[model samples]
Target: MGDLERELRDLSTWLETPEPPDVRAQVRERLHRPARRWRPLAAAALAAVLVAVLPPTRAAVADVVSGLLRFAGVSIAVSPEQTTPSGVASPLPGQRVAGLDEAQRAVRFPIRLPAKLGPPERVLVADPDPTGACRVATLLYDGGALRVDAFDGRLNLSFHKEVIPPGAEWVEVNGDFAVWVDGPHVLSYVDRAGTVHKESARLAASTLIWQDADVSYRLEGARTQAEAIEIARSLR
Candidate 1:
């Protein structure tokens, strides 16, 4: 977290902000089911996914949001070549150390842990809103080589945006659309207050993002798409 501290100290000035597997039709069918079980926001999110699909290819799903490419509630803008990964990651906003139980109790939704990776080494929670609910829960594993972050995306659009080149490919996470970033990227998000903030020192090696049961998650530092998806599908 070198320059990251400096950047965070300055703050106040920042901007914003997949895949297949399983049968493609299966993904569409799964997307359809959420609308019935969820409220209107889920419906809107489902509609976005469905339209990208009809009711989908990775390219077909592309929708420009705030002048950046977007999909599955995440936005992307390519990062510059000059900057390189420092092998360190930025913590989520308002993040604090906590036990797993304490972390789960803080969030409205379930904080799923990947069964494939067993228990995480550490649990962190971020409370960014006034409602006393955790906005994000992060699990760190393998000396931080693997990390999973779960956040409520039902009410937030463009919640996680990244600045990395456009080659992120599509993969499958239990029949839902997921995106994988193969290289390091700059991560940012819109807080509950709608202010933009940068995930300083956020140099992701590889990432897999998918939404399940209204929780949107991003798993970082996996070395390959297959491994990322396997861990993601094992979430429980």
Candidate 2:
């Protein structure tokens, strides 16, 4: 057995021993001889002895001691390094394309298009996910290099657990508030099951997120905030 386990076992064994007759008599005598300045110290010692001797009390004390020791030097880092998942960052997988009409039939929300960007090169629809139990549709422009993701809910993610990067700016998009995070920030999302999705962690494009009514949108691949705002304004 390991040293710690062996020591615990030995302590348990020693605590199980019955007090000798003389020891019991001495304990009784000490209890009777009270009211002195050392009486509080003696009572505390007696309580400790009781805790060590009783099986239930000893087990409880051991649990508390072990827990405190285990957490002594452990520190949880909440910085950028801790936000991204451990595995090699991978690209979003299995993204397929469909026509705008087909995508509209598949998703639960209305799709908005940017007049400036014109018709998208590809329309990608995401299956209903557990996080929001709603479908997400993506409009890919510029040969699928630029994307606008439209869904039916809010992106309520905590900055501590998700990658919001170092600089997050709040701005207005078509009279609605939006958050712009510069890339390549770790692209992570929490699903309905509260699980983290980091498949797009290594993407280099900037992102702009905004909401209107029940619909939310995320525009990616803009070179600057002004360009993103202009594109967002074009969304109808």
Among these predictions, the greatest TM-score belongs to 1
User: What are the lDDT scores of the predictions, listed in order?
Assistant: 0.63, 0.54
Cα lDDT of model 2 by residue, 197-223, tens digit: 654344336777766665767788988
Candidate 2 deviant stretches above 4 angstroms: 1-95, 129-134, 154-165
Each prediction's TM-score versus the true structure? 0.67, 0.56
| TM-score of candidate 2 versus the correct structure, residues matched by position | 0.56
Clash pairs (backbone) in predicted model 2 = 130-192, 131-191, 131-192
Return the top candidate by lDDT: 1
Query: Candidate 1, residues 29-126: lDDT per residue as tens digits?
Result: 55434334354344244335434433211221343233254554566665445264344556657789989999889989898878899999999888
Report lDDT (Cα) of residue 108, candidate 2: 74
Model 2 residue 28 CA deviation (Å) reads: 70
Clashes found in each candidate (C-alpha, N, C closer than 3 A): 5, 3
Q: What is the lDDT of residue 157 in candidate 1?
A: 46
